[model samples]
Target: MMSTSFLHPCLRRMLSDRGGNFGIMTAIMAPVLLGAAGLAIDYSNMALSQRQLQESTDSAALAAATALASGKVADEAAAKTLAKDFVVGQMTNYAGTASASAIRNATNVDITTSTSSTSKSYSVTVATSYRLGLTPFMNLLGHSTIDISTTSSTTSGTSQTRSALSMELVLDQSGSMGYDTNTCAQYKKNGTTCKTYVVKIDALKQASASLFDALDKADPQHTLVRTGVISYSNGLLRDWTNKVTSVSAMDWGTTKSRDYVTTLSPDGGTDATEPMQLADDTIKKNANSTDAESVAHQKKGNSKVDRFIILMTDGEMTGNSNTWNKDKDQSVRDKCDAAKTDGITLFTVAFMAPDKGKSLLQYCASPGGNYYEAETMEKLVADFESIAQTATKAATLLTN
Candidate 1:
């Protein structure tokens, strides 16, 4: 047996050793445990803040997009106001608070608008941001806050607007058409019973110029009208392609003139397929002549500011006579289909088409409103005027 004093000493030592180990363990675990808890809370808060920020930004972007779609030109003042409303509408103390700051900071807005006499549309973009407050753990980790951002865009177009209009004039020039003396006439009877005469070329130029003069002087409430001409007989004539095909496009800016009419000297073998191809090509090539407007148009399904095709022909597919071959016919049909594919409204005119070609011309135009044939100069001019007026009315109804 041990003496009481020695036993007390050993018992005391054992108790002290146990207490020391417990204290050491507690000291090591206190910071670690606290840090772990802080981390969990901080991460949770971060996630929540991020989700809310996304929602806020999304809503703000949508609001701006809606405004843009409403045809509001994204002028700077309008954009700023749009941003303000978007942010303030969603937050507490919207007009006066940090939420407002967040909203202002978040709003990155862009508005683009294009107008033709027949159509008009706009594009809007809104960007927003939100701040995530730092969690206690983050503070302890020497971080204060995190930021998040988001962006969205929308485009809208409307037709028949009073602001802008797009017009396409198609003219027919074929060699067989040269036998007439008047601007747009064909010999219906011998001199004893002759009516009137107007060569196809002369009549087209006069009608085109007159139409341009009328529309050029007319005013749309807030739109600009643009006209492009496609002169076809054998093949389509664009400035580039038509020039190469010996067709000329006079550069006319008379009365807000943009792109002018293509001049057809009547050289190609007539292929009813030409006008459709040229119209399709021009629409595809120029959504808007300018870049800023082009981007806006692209956003709206690459829609043209306004779309139109005027098919004026004197004869049928006589040249590429083979064009009527099933394969060639299909190809031409495909081109027509492509015009429809491009969302163009086609108009056809038969100045002096033979009975066979007349039927073909009628079939090629928009049913009920597009086919017109004239036998004399007076009729030809009257027909040109009628076609012009009708086309103008229809084009005026398209989006601007």
Candidate 2:
């Protein structure tokens, strides 16, 4: 009944009115949108500042811990002041003087220091709090400020044993030495290959002796060094035995100890796992006991002594032709893990291992434990020395 035309003024007016409403709505919301962007920028800046402060505080705490490890400070006040000063000084210089205001306003830093169970070590904790900058947009969103915090800790200890060392030198006497491989061609100075008389096993033995000599020379105190040897091929050539000849039953001092050697005659199958297990056992048993050396070193307040195992193998884990892979000898790994749980350090040395075997040897060490691969007698000798030094450093830091 009501007539309608294709173009109508009423319809056009309705469309125009909607567009006006949209414009009004956008005007009302524009500030809110801009404020949100500002808020995002503020939050990002706060996060970055928090991260920087945390890093600075962490470094400070570590430095303080090292200083405390010297055993020079006796009281808590001294320790705290030392830690705070170290942390503040480091952080202030971290970014130069120009950023001093930025650092101060961005974070609140604190450091706490405490002595170890033994009076020789110190533990430090660093904490930092960052106050968040409010974004203009965030104000409309109801957040005035945001706060972030982070904390970190570290420990340092001094060396109490003057000539402390735990060593296990393994010599390989496998038949591989009978036939000179292309690899052995280089060690020969003259036309004759060293393999002709001194086989691979003999070279290894010499290297082991050299390592002992180094240890003897490095010993500062005559009564402090302890040494062991494990030789393996088919079965364990040697058992878990301590120093063949201990110089003196003294503690905390090195003694002129006789060098010991355990040589394996190449003849049987190869089971590398057994030797490692046995060496680990020997170190654990000796460290726990009050031997002449331990008795001499006992003090009023000191942490429990630690043991170490240095295992070496020339080939992959193979013997009896039944198993060459390490997965089959998980029992050995379990034992090593148990020793580590008991606080024994484990190191592994591999000779002439392929890629796969090398990784296996490295894994034999506990996390962050020592793992070295040596192809020649010289490298093997060097590996032993390095392992000895690392163990000494760790022991000093832990016992001091």
Residue-wise lDDT of candidate 2 within 1-400, one digit each (tens)? 8778756988897777755777898899888777879777886877676676677777766766666676566655566666555545555654456645554454333434443332355567766554555866777777777776677777776645443555554444555544333345344666565543445566555556655566566555434456656555664554358433211121232222122343245655566566666655555545465643244334422234446666666665566563465663465567667767755777877777666557666777867748888776678767777876676565553353
Q: What TM-score goes with each of the models?
A: 0.45, 0.47
Model 1: lDDT equals 0.58
Clashes of each: 32, 13
RMSD of each: 13.4, 17.9
Stretches off by above 4 angstroms in model 1 are 1-160, 181-197, 219-223, 236-264, 284-304, 320-330, 395-400
Q: In candidate 1, how many Å is residue 95 off?
A: 51
Q: How far in Å is the alpha carbon of 172 misplaced in model 2?
A: 4.0
lDDT of 2 at 265: 50
Worst 10 residues of 2 by lDDT: 245-254
Summarize candidate 1's per-residue lDDT along 1-400 as a digit string, tens digits.
8568768888888777754787889898887777787788878876765566556556665565555555463554675586557655665432246567656755666767777645556666666766666656657667677776666666556655432345556566666655564442444556454466655666666666665655655533223445556555556534654354423332122332322342445555576565667556655434445533344444433343545566666665665452433443345556766776666666666776666567666666666676677766566666656755665565454332
